[model samples]
Target: MEAEKKVIIVRFSGELSIKPDAEKYQAIERLCKQISLRLSEKNVFIDITHFHDRFQIKVSEQEVQSVCAVLDRSFGVGNYSLVDFQCSSKEEQILRLVPNYQDQFSGAEFRVRVKRSGQHSYSSMDLEKKAGAILGKTAKVNLSFPQKVLHIEVINEEAFLYSEKRKGPGGLPPHKRERALVLMSGGFDSAVAAWMLMKRGVCVDYLFCNMGGKSTERQTLQIAKVLSDLWNPDPIAKFISLDFTDSIEDIKKHSSLTYRQILLKCKMYEAASNVSKILGCYAIVTGEALGQVSSQSLQNLRAIDLSTRVSVLRPCIGMDKQEIIKKAYEIGTGVLSAKVLELCGITQGKAVRKANPSKTDEYLQSLDQSLIEKAIQERTEILLKDVDGKMLQSEYLFVDEISEGYEVIDCRTQKEFSQWHYAGARNLSLRELLANLKSLNKKKKYVLYCSFGTQTPVAAEIMQQSGFQAYAFKGGIGKLRSLQK
Candidate 1:
């Protein structure tokens, strides 16, 4: 029998802080479960050394390894090394490891970069020479770009040696105890806000409300599902969810294209406050950038604030679109988020308008208060998915379109489907998928998903070959779960 290979997963390149710790630690747990469901391998290991500044939970040895191994394959890790690790002091890190790196690549053309977490004994020039001396004079490598590169980390207490550049969910790590409700629009801004907060360790729950319009209705909720799927692939994400759709829609029923944006937002905050009260969340989060849109104006923002009692957090408020995209890239959610098709993208007015607080208030008052309450009572719901197609636990504002025509299917386990599933996708497991397959309507649209994207493909492929039109959720249950606010 082949020996089980042991691989190490390391996290690097993120600024750590104490913001989303609760949500972050929960994410770690969720990630572990997602990994376990993926592969049968038993020798994976993960070291969250880069989370030095954050308060991460200490998982068991087996659990850590399991999470590490799964993420390596699913999320595209930089280096999954099969080697022994020696954690020693700083001086030892330099003297012992430097020579070892040289011996490994005797003639390979390469460059060495030394990064210090604190002051070190060797000068910058001295370290390069040391690396060069260790390698020998025969090696010809460009410092700017080399075939092989060595990364040396000199920390305050110790050092680490790795042959690869690892990537991390960069941003401030999630801090425990801090809570924020995200204003999740199915657009770039809100999605980026949630990402920023997740990086800093803030446990962010979502409050996505869509105003009633002639455009594709449930499409916004579907978009939220995509983002939720990408972020919380772990089937355990109760971290995010939907409020009510009807409540917000009611506001729009009594309003129009004029100040509808302002009034609708105010009502959303009100319903969000109710959601906050129920979920024990503290503040609200949004994807607000300075001067980005009419509703984002400082005056209009203040008017919207009048609807809620909690503090509001705008993670993207100070960031530009480019900056937000860069962060998204670092977190690996860029490609998935990029694929989303939001209905609201084309509706914005070209002329920039600063909000008038007084006018915004007037707009809010113009809507029927009775209609607002009714909209709150009739909330819509949805599920989010991740890059790998795991559905995040989510709740979204209800749109009438869900029950209208489309056929939704839950490809999760029987128990999972029983516990909860999308509104239309009756409970069905992959094992029993084909048996019940004949019942599906061939003419209608369909969706398939597993807990994360594991089993959906099997069902999707079967349906497609069987002459039924089908779509496999890129991310599965974890994404869907994030939609339940």
Candidate 2:
């Protein structure tokens, strides 16, 4: 019988597939669960027939690319291919699928490979020779150094054929391993590190210390969300934002500038440790590359690590910046991380490489424990989702209220502001506003505006939290312009 049906053959990574029988079986089960969870989001149904040496997934032909995208994000998949078609166990059936491989092998040197299981009268070599003879009519056949390879799999009474295969994320399925609290900074390093842990099957929850303002909080939360969506589909990863403004102020006042950077990290570890206690996670992850900066020096890192008793996992400790950025791009966080505004004032001066532990302890002892406790007490949790799909519940200022007593702050770049802006609107970007937080007239009410309006509410929330009368301009500048016209 000859019938064309769409199927995918999934191969597990060597690391997971080579485990002991029981462990391998469990890992495969975890992978199957993840596959089903992630694909369900696309409204695509995947039917898994069995799991042994390979997984057989059947889906609609239209969803092949979508399935491949989801499989690329999954950790346990080593490689997968969309079978061109399935046919009965016969040599003539193989010839039917040969026409489909012409475009791929037409102008290139190719080879035919065959694999078989169960009863087969003909040897694998015999099948390969017969197929290669017909396929060579379309292209040159090079048994070695071929540009393309046509693969054939015969199992029981069925046979599958495909020309291309794609590599997967190649790690354990997330949540199959233990969970950890990652000190996510929304930067290249920590994002990549969190991804690394997730690749190894460790479910990662994000802990962000809001060092700048609401912008930083939103950025970090969004970054964590990106990691969460990539790693785990179920058991939504929790993003905890700690208001470190007071703590940042304390460090700036008491600690020397040279040590401010290291002290900030130490405080982060302390806060993370406390958060870990509440979450029941014993491990912490960071993006600290060894000697990447003064704060990441061996001595400074030791001082920072001493703040928490839990195991600190640094997957990128030996990698350089370029490598981490490349991984970030590959995993889909590069563009978002690149857009995150770098808020100034977290580190005011050059950091010291060799920080003494006793001195660090002295600085930690001098800080107000009440403020640290208060920071944790005021922690906010943001559940990550698509912006338009979720109701953020942020307060807003309607168009009619703009002319009242509110001072309008155009949060767009100078280039955009120079083109056209609201009358008497003062241009202050998110970056400039954060850097000049102390200089703002907090006595006056303020309305923040952005290009698309998606970002203003976050800025407004930060201002409100800092005791300022602030609200996001409803629908942002786009709506405001339409109202004026």
Error of 1 at 106 (Å): 6.6
Poorest 10 consecutive residues by lDDT, candidate 2: 386-395
Q: What is candidate 1's lDDT per residue for 222-263, written digit by digit as tens? A: 334434444433232233333335544554566445566666
* Backbone clash count for every predicted candidate, in the order shown: 77, 0
Runs with alpha carbons beyond 4 Å of true place in candidate 2: 1-5, 99-103, 343-345, 385-485
lDDT of each: 0.54, 0.78
- What TM-score, to 2 decimals, does candidate 1 have? 0.56
- State every prediction's TM-score relative to the real structure: 0.56, 0.78
Give the range where candidate 1 is weakest over 10 consecutive residues by summed lDDT.
Answer: 392-401
Which candidate has the top score in lDDT? 2
Best by TM-score: 2
Question: Stretches of candidate 1 above 4 Å error?
Answer: 1-134, 140-161, 172-176, 211-257, 322-352, 380-451, 454-485
